[model samples]
Target: MRTGAAATYDPFASYADPREPLFTSTVVSVIGNIGMGKSTCMKCLFVLRPLLLGRRVVVLDKKRQGAEGEYGPIARAMGTQPVRLVPGGGPGASCINLIDPRIGIATSSGAATSEGRPAGQLELVQRVIAEYLGHSLDVLGIEALRVALLAAPGRAAADSREPTLLDLIWCLQHPHDGQVRSLYDDSWTAADVYGWGREAAATLLVLANGELGGVIDGPTSPEVSVDHPAGLTVFDISSLPNSGPALGIVMLLIQTWLSGLLAQRSAARQQTILVVEEGWHVSSSASLGEMFREQAKLSRALGLCLVAGFHHPSDLPHGSPARALMKESSTLFLFGQSEEVEVRETLSIAQLPRELGDLIRSLPQGECVLVKAGADPEHVSIGISDWEAAVTNTDAQLTGDAYG
Candidate 1:
């Protein structure tokens, strides 16, 4: 994340003077075991000073405390509350309209086919199906769903009406006249294609009515806004089931939405920052990981920075997009890791000096080694003012109810 007069933001007084630029890396990674100060280190490195300077920020608060998450209180302090999503729906629950044309178009690649229709929409449907279902579809199922979505929005005025998973499910089960038959020759009847569509649609129905139905199925709630001027949008997916597949789907959608916003900001040259906690959920999926890697690669040109934090390097398995992100990150903060194996792996991935491994193993609380890509590492102790320290503490929810 670049900070300076160019960004129209200020640096922390303790770190740099207002006139001097501080923390000018485009991609940052924070790694450590839980309670080893990963969150606190991130807050010190990105949250406190940047927000104070009016740089809009978004965080995926996977810890899910609603108004009580690590960044929720800080976001509210900046004049907005974190948009919270809960299962079974609740007082502050927020639902995203996945079928909104705006969302669909945001993922649109602007690539058109021979028929002059945007090819991106079909790809968008394919991705949503893969992500939400937590698996891949057969070639027939993919084509069937594509045809259904092509009509879901009604080809002529696709965005005129909002299409829900129910609509897709219905289209899949019931052949649309010649549509289903066209997918195959007389060798296979329309019934065969419909069967595949029905199978794929069944999985989607689970996303619409099953555990995460409340959050992803319905008219988009007014609670969440992608364009917040205050510079902070936190999607508290904490309450969503932590099952790896389920979390991966929700996080992918959120990331897609943010990418759309970032794409829009490219012209303004706004320095956009996306901070994700427990990012392993995203990297675990090869598809999502590749998507993230592409986004990070495009960040510099788009004027965006990504800060991803997780408990251990294993969170991003070897050859994962997230691990690639770590390799590309110019700035990194290494908080102490309690486990010996994890520490060694993190150090290996981080390429820190072997001798520092022992120090990292026993590093005191709130102390971390700051390493910039291609530069010597610095063991800097994060020193925040008392009031700042209290506000950034992730444990405020543990000690008392004061955080919310």
Candidate 2:
């Protein structure tokens, strides 16, 4: 973790000329192996340092420790608690509506559509359904879902509330002939539309009433808000199962909501950094990856910076969009990786020379290579205060008599 010389790295420091900037965007990718101090690096450098500068930090914490998320201690130290979301609505649970109109307007080509909802919202809902069904929806199925989404708001108007997944489901189960034919040709009948949408509706029915009930099927919980005065927000989704689409679905919902909320705050000129640990959950999926790619393009304009951490670039398949996204990061922090395949993949993605493979593999804990675009990579060690070391420690549970 030792370098020839020590210099401060500030991503926000500006140059005299606007045309020639130090970095293109604030997007960062931190890659390393498990237990290689990836989280520690992110906590100290991104979370702690950014908070000191009056910047907001939002974490989608997926790593569970004991009964809470790994970032719980950090949140509590900042005078806030992680927004722990539990399934089936318990004593302390948070919910986010899938179709909340507050999601701002989605434009086709710089112009707001007549639907008055973000186009991403429609894609989000469709992606959730596709996740549940284990495949993409067919043409008729996609049209049916679109028609149902368009009708959901009107259906919920009777109850004087915002549209929820339940309302969308109801609309799908009962397709309006006019709406169906309007989307397609006049030959499309209500029964035909109902058949096309029946499977998707049934899939959504299981999602709303099954094990994940109350998580996203109902109205958004008042407790859910991105603008916390303490300048730190953690969505504790650790309770979600790691193997299924549940985690990916919830991540998408949270990310979409964050985009909408941040879009509204564009005038405030507040800079926010969003951290997604175990980022492959978003990048591995084609749908989620596309959504995130679009969001990353807008990160600069929205006054937002995305800090995504992955165990290694090889976690994604070859030619994956995730790899492309990693290459586009303005800054990269690469930690020790023992496996040769992983080492080579990391180097290839970071565009580093193959000769550095031995150096990367031999990096000690709390040490990493800082790679910035248009600059030579620097070997740096992460130095933290005693208090930070105490707060960022993740080995307390394993510190007892066994090792001693």
Best-matching candidate per TM-score? 2
Q: lDDT per residue, candidate 1, 164-239, as tens digits?
A: 6566677777766666556554666667767768757787787777666777666666536667666778777766
Question: Model 2: how large is the Cα RMSD against the reference?
Answer: 4.9
| Clashing pairs for predicted structure model 2, backbone only | none
Query: TM-score per candidate, in order?
Result: 0.75, 0.77
Put down candidate 2 lDDT per residue, 295-338, tens digits, no spaces.
Answer: 77888788878788888677787666577678788888999999
**Against the hidden true structure, what lDDT does model 2 obtain?**
0.77
lDDT of each structure? 0.66, 0.77
| Cα lDDT for residue 22, candidate 2 | 55
For residue 212, what is the lDDT in candidate 2?
Answer: 65
* Candidate 2 residue-wise lDDT at 399: 71
Residue range with the least summed lDDT across 10 consecutive positions in model 2: 103-112
**Steric overlap count per candidate:** 4, 0
For model 1, name the residue pairs that clash.
Answer: 1-25, 56-231, 57-231, 64-238
